[model samples]
Target: MASNKSAFVDDKGKPLRIADSAMPKPGADDIVVRNHAVAINTIDPAQADGFLIKQYPTVLGHDLAGEVFDVGSNVKRFKKGDRVIGHARQFLTGQPEDGAFSLYSRVPAGNAAILPDRFEYKQGVVLPLAIDTAACGFYEEGYMQLELPSLDAKPNGRVVVVYGGSSSVGIAAIQLAVNAGYRVIATSSSKNSNLCREAGASEVFDYKAESIAGDIAKAVGDDQFVGLFNAIGIPESFDVVNPIMEKLNGGFLANTKPPGKLPSFIDAKFVLCIGDFGFPVWENFITKALESGKLKCLPEPKVVGKGLDSLQEAFEVRNGEVSAQKVVVEL
Candidate 1:
């Protein structure tokens, strides 16, 4: 075991400072990882500003990629020296216990999956958050059942729209839908249109265009869209997409909202992604997709600074910047 320093914000809401914490011990179904990289997300700043509700003095990271340093006796999936990535904390309380923004992390064995030899730890860090979000959005309980269409058949040519296609969650959703043979149309800034197309979108539309829904309808034809993935979660975006989406028979919209009422003519499905949904559901699929080359890694996050001490600066960059790429801290 190794002791490490962690960056944490005090109650005053000032910049995070390094504090000493004990090295975590692995339980019977746990593996201890010596962290190599941790990716920052939009939620980090909300948590920092106390906008996103969570336990105070909490370790804030969730997406992690690193090498296994130790394993418990019952951990049969991974051994020492293996590289893996998964959920940072052991449970899915939405409040972090010990997070990945530190030198070492103790991850539950069931939540960990081995990284492919062809991929680096930094690239692997981008998988968990996106994959988990997509899986939970599509298959979580009480949502429409996802029955696989016939193997030797066409997909009834149904259209699906993904808002914010360049965002991490939108990228994953587009790829998943396209691989499953659905015709996907996505919205992105003009600069990210090529990237969205490469991710398997049938067509990319400019979100800033005054009539985005009409443009999508013209491309895919009338009343063809059956589902929507709103990765951006903006209230105005929902207002814009609702009228066009109402044409479908039983179309549904999946978003990150935490249990709230949706506008008329649209059914909003609240997705809470965590270990409770069966950790292996996403971890297994992502590992196989990586091994088979079905899923490609996002651009390597631009490293702002090195080691745990740089977390404050990294957090500042995450809060201030409005770019498509993730900000990662190398440990």
Candidate 2:
């Protein structure tokens, strides 16, 4: 059996510690990954705050890219030594053994996708949870539920405004929306506008502009969007996108944060993207897209440090400020 070194949060609201432990054993539906690189998410703090943790001395992490260490017999798609990117759901599942902030993690087979050889571990780690969050906004029936993308999908003539398009989920939302055939109008800083365009956004606007909302509204004059997704999910973002929604009189607005007050005419839902529902997309489309050059990891990976030992500082950095680049820690 392989030994494991994990970043453990002994209790809620505690600092993470690097510790040696036994490697995780796979459940019938689990696939253990020897993580080469891991990425942090906004949800890590909440997990450490006791929001999603199931027990003390638990682990907290959501994104990782690695090689398969082992697999449960029931897992047919992967075996030992496969390269994979996974959404570690330890916080959601409340299982310490499955946490991604470790040398080894056993995530559900459903929460993972095969990583293409062209992309390195750091570049790919940024996608797992962010892509799931994006999928929740667009594919989940509780949220957008507009349509699912396939290998040969065509444009459906729908539009989606992905506010904060330079953010991690925003990048994923732009790519996924376009893949699903919606024309994506996205917002990012002028510095990151090209990133949004490269992610398949049909048009990109500067969110820092004095008239961002009006700019978006004017850009889409008379063109109705099926919905708008607030990737930043802050009240300020909703305030910005609300005017655009109002232009069309009504549509959908799915938020990544808790649902707050909204314009009466707007139809909206708050979605937490932690579940097996996002599996089909990961399994069905991501690999093919990557291999075909249709899906490129974005905005890009900015390596923070190396090893599980650096995770505390890494998570702190992620909790702090970052721009178009997602923070990554190589194991």
Candidate 3:
């Protein structure tokens, strides 16, 4: 049996501990990966504090990029030595082996995609959670419900607004919506405008601008407006997002966080990224797009530290003032 070492949080609000764990045994439709890099997200801090987490001394993480170590009887898309990016499902399954804050993790085949050799592990590690979250906000029926991404997506002549376009989910949403045939108008700080445009957004507005709401509205005028995908779901973001929603005469607000109260005119809901929402995208679009250079590992990754012991530092860095870059730990 192969041994595993993971950074575990023994209790709520506790520090991370490095300890040995049993190697993951893959079930049918699963693969065990030797993680080369793992990216941290905003939700990790909350999970460490016990939000939505059911057990103590559990491992926590959602994004990993590595090479396949083992495959289950039912997993055909991957084999030993194949490189991959995975959306770790510990949040949903409550299993230590399913977490990414470790040297090795068991990943559901549907929640993973092949990582093309063109990109490094740190670069591709930024995609899993961001991709899944964007998929939830854009493809799910209750959310934007637009269209699934494809290799050759013809323009559908509709528009979707993505606020905070430089953020991880914002960048993914912009790319996915564009690949799904929707025109995207995105918001970012002036410094990140180019980053959003590079992600396929037709226009980028400065969110800090006082006239941001009106500017985005003017850009979407008389077009087939799909809705708004608010990647920045903080309360402060609502001040800007609400005005834009009102300007568009009320449209679907697919928020990435818990949406606060809004006027009766706005159709809004908080989007939880957990689920099989990413399966179709992962299985159908991700690998092809990456191979063709259509899907980019955007915003780049800032590797904060190395090995499982660095995961705690990576978490802290993610909680700091990170902008347009994901904090990663190279294992």
Candidate 4:
């Protein structure tokens, strides 16, 4: 087994080298995973470009699918050789821990979930962050609080709109809403319409169309949607959906920077998935959902190339590509 391997970003905000280092020893509450695949998220590029940069030469991956090679003595949830997914550290805290870019990664026991037998490493790798984001939107502070007054009533066949439906978070939102029996309408490029449909969206609107919001309103019958989930945090996304939001009965869930002024009629809730280490409820909900397969994993990630040598190329590809699929690196 290789002792240490990582893809590090240089001072110029570019991926410079994949080098060898010391492998981490498991702590009493941690497990070491022999990584098979690592999934890329937008946050990867953001960190690389200093959007959320904390330290230089930081390892740049969050999601991974692998097998447990060893566990800390206090860890009881997993055994050696068990396939698993490593949840990203939401709050970096003060640790300089290497992320999933390396061949072996150490994660807390509560931050790892056993992969279902039906999923391959690639299929399971993209889910941890996306699922957590969706779970945050669905539940309250990480607990599965299904107490929304709208859900408790009789079948009103309420509608929920998900903007940027082709994104990983959008996909998870659609699935979670549909599984909860809500009618889902989503907006995405025409090319990704099929993916939106496959994720259980009742209606898919071409976001690139000139009258995209109008098209969504026409389909849902003028403000029939109860909630709106904005997976894309762009300012234009908020503008396009604002009109429809006026007609909704409930609030909106946004994954962008929190807005300063609240909108009328619709409650706008900004969802920041990470940066909260004190919330044990959210972690528990995600762990249960993944283990139970209530939250289905994304399709097998498209591997750019094998090993750390391909890191820079992979980063470039990820930064430029706009596919609905998740980009992954094989270790």
Please list the C-alpha lDDT of all candidates, in the order they appear.
Answer: 0.71, 0.85, 0.91, 0.70
Ranking by TM-score: 3, 2, 1, 4
Better model by lDDT: candidate 2 vs candidate 4: 2
Q: What is the total number of backbone clashes in candidate 3?
A: 0
Tens digits of per-residue lDDT for model 3, 266-317: 7888877777888999999999998987788998999998898887777788
Give one clash count per candidate, in the order shown.
0, 0, 0, 1
Cα lDDT tens digits for candidate 1, 1-331: 4676666656536667678866777889888888888888777666667655455566667778899988988988889999888667622443333577767777777667888889888778876667667666666676533423222225557777888888877887777676566788998889998878887787999888878767776777763666788877767776656655653433678876552556576777866545445364444555676777666676447787778888888888888855567788888
Task: Superpose all Cα atoms of candidate 4 onto the true structure and report the RMSD in Å to 1 decimal.
Answer: 4.2
Model 3 alpha-carbon drift over 4 Å, by segment = none
Q: Estimated TM-score per prediction?
A: 0.87, 0.95, 0.98, 0.82
User: Which scores greater on lDDT, model 1 or model 2?
Assistant: 2
Give the range of the ten consecutive residues with the poorest summed lDDT in model 1: 144-153
RMSD in angstroms between candidate 2 and the native structure over all alpha carbons: 1.5
Candidate with best TM-score? 3
How would the candidate models be sorted by lDDT, starting from the highest?
Answer: 3, 2, 1, 4
| Candidate 2 pairs with clashing backbones | none
Q: lDDT tens digits, residues 252-273, model 4?
A: 5555446546467656677665
The lDDT leader among the candidates is 3
Report the error of model 1 at residue 186, Å. 1.3
Task: Return the number of clashes found in candidate 2.
Answer: 0
